[model samples]
Target: MNKEVKELDLIIIGAGPAGLTAAIYASRAKLNMLLIEDAIVGGQVRSSYTIENYPGFKKVEGGTLADLMQEQAQELGAEIDEFDMVERVQFSDSEKIVETSSYIYKPKAVIISTGAVPRKLPIANEEKYAGKGVHYCAVCDGAMYEGKTVGVVGGGNSALEEALFLSRFAEKVILVRRYDYFKGEKATLDEVLNHPKIEVMYNWDLVDVNGAEFMEKAKIKNTLTGEEKEIVMDAVFGYIGTEPKTKLFKDYINLNPQGYILTDENMRTNIKGVYGAGDVREKAFRQITTAVADGTISALDAEKYIVESKRVK
Candidate 1:
């Protein structure tokens, strides 16, 4: 017997905070929606040990926050299917069909909430010390180094911005850049330059992470001079960049040079029935608050599209 194709009013392609939140709103609106996720629901947020910046909770574990979102979405009647990987998405006329290894889903609208992953430094044994010492988000891990020394890698807005964020906690934050100059917002640059706790070091690259069980030193090399030095730091934060999880959708949508999906203010993509949200969409900021906001906009906009198209379930 042939496998039956599942149908829904809206199909969400990721189950992260954005996707789960979309499911919550879509299901609450009584829309027949299905949320699919192959990995953990929280996405990159799960990697964060703790988060204090998110509103409401002064401090909460990242995994706990993710679980709450997932539970809340399910409690609201959203049919969320875990461990389902979407292979492709094909848009035909006013309908969007998503194909997976196990099932094919045809929905009136599709919301892509697939998130992004942090860019890693190509250094020896870098992966081994990710949580122990090598970290990506300054806001998430900076407090652990309060009154201690840490090194930050990158020169862009995120790097500079995080450097400033880390300055509030870490006694000393050394901004390391491979190039000779910074390439982020001027205001952020001014702040970083003026920050008493920040020291900018250009023309240097992080080449190695040296530690026994946990990280104890960060080895850097001067690109122009070929001189190397090991900094006595507690941890190294990489803000080099992030890679959006849109490889499968690149053929169907417009993307920036860095591969982030292009979407309007309301998270609507160029396609009529397809939308992009969360870290996958190109935006100035990528935070839990912004991602949740994106999900709300996408779900509501998708609802509007479905009604206007007369595809109510």
Candidate 2:
């Protein structure tokens, strides 16, 4: 049997907040749109237990927020296809083609909002103890170490943020960093540094993770003196760094040195009919609020492009 092919006005590559928000805006603009997601629609936000930062709600479940966003987008006539992974993209001057595991879709424009993935430490036994003890996202695994000791690796914004977040649930939190100085924002650094529950271990690197069934201890090394020490912990959270999910567009879009998509202030890429948003784009902040803002901006920019193109013809 031949596969079905559909042509749409806009094809949003992810179903996360950014993608869904874009769909909401594009659908409201009366654009025939399609949203494709490889996994569940929530993206990383679904793993969070409570989101107190998002405006309006003092405290709301992450999954609940995701469900609401999905429902809102679908209610606006956005066609959502779950479990469809975008394998490749072919962009021309006039249109863009997205090839997925199940089918091929041609759209007048495309919005890339694939977001990012966690970065892992090069320490030994890190992968071996993935589910056993070591975790990359505190929001995803913080409940497992409730009232227990946990170690956070890295000194960036995310590391300090995770340390602060973990302190709410964990009994004790140790933050380990290779550099003596932290690269996170001053406010975040000060908050974590002064927090009663968090202890800072400067100039130290995680050398190994030791455990049988789960993580029991972490071997840390002093970067300055080459001294090694072991600390007992119930779990380890790695907040080192994040890598953008832009590999699928490697052949089509221009990327920066860090692999984020290169886009202008309007979220327009070098390609005329293609745009990018969220953490995948070269931006100052990678917060959920920023991603939502980017989605709105990109949708408007895409609408302008579509209207101008139609007028010229």
Candidate 3:
């Protein structure tokens, strides 16, 4: 039997800050809409232990902020469907079809806010030791290394934050950075530097990992002097960077060399009646505030397009 087919004014593809923000606006506009998420509603924001930069809040947990966003959207009458994976999409100027595991949606406008995924470490046996010793989310795997030693790779906000979070569980946290200076916020960098449990390795790169069953040693080399050293750790957490999660829409959308969707200032992709927002789009910066802004612009643009198209019809 065929799946149920429902039509609406718009369909938001992600429930992160971007998609949630769009849903809030769309609901206020009284547009028939649905927000779908394959994973948790909060997206990457849930991973953060503490967030202080977001406006209006002095300090808040990432999960709490996400919950507030989700609450606001729902209160605004936005219909959200969680854990429904979109299987396929067909976009055009007149109509767009989105197919998921449970239903098939035919919406007049579609917003893509799938966001990005963590970049993996490019070291030997990294895949073999993925779950055993190599992990991307310290929040999820840090508890597993209780009273043990773990190494964190990267020099950005995520690396610094994860190191602090891991320090609570690991007896010692080795933060490995290839650059001489950290690139994250000054406050976060300062905290990591001052934390006694965390050891910051400047101008050093993790070249390899060695072990039989689980990871035993991480081989790091000094970038300036070419000196190498091995640190014995139970696990390695990588936060080098992230790549766009555009695999589902890559063939249909115009993407840059780095695989981020290319969009105009209005958040309109090359395809009409379709839009890209948040970390999934090609932008200089990726932040919760920026993603919210992107979602607002796209939803408004999409609403206008739908109204104009109705007149034309």
Measured by lDDT, the strongest candidate is: 3
Best by TM-score: 3
- Local accuracy of candidate 1 as per-residue lDDT tens digits, 160-207: 877877888889999999998887878779989999999999899998
- Please report how far candidate 1 places residue 82 from its true position, in Å: 1.6
Residue-by-residue lDDT tens digits, candidate 3, 158-269: 8998999999999999999998898899999988989999998899999988888999999999999999988898899999889988888877889999999999999999
TM-score of each: 0.74, 0.90, 0.96
Query: Residue 111 in model 2: shift from native, Å?
Result: 0.2
Q: Quote model 2's TM-score.
A: 0.90
Worst 10 residues of 2 by lDDT: 44-53
* TM-score for candidate 3: 0.96
Which prediction has more favorable lDDT, 1 or 3? 3
Model 3 stretches with alpha carbons more than 4 Å out: none
Ranking by lDDT: 3, 2, 1
Q: Among all windows of ten consecutive residues in candidate 1, which has the lowest summed lDDT?
A: 44-53
Scanning candidate 3 in windows of ten residues, the lowest lDDT window is: 88-97
Segments in model 2 whose C-alpha atoms lie over 4 Å from true places? 57-61, 181-196
Which pairs of residues collide in model 2?
none
**In model 3, what lDDT does residue 69 have?**
96
> Relative to the unseen true structure, what is the C-alpha lDDT of residue 282 in candidate 3, on a scale of 0 to 100?
94
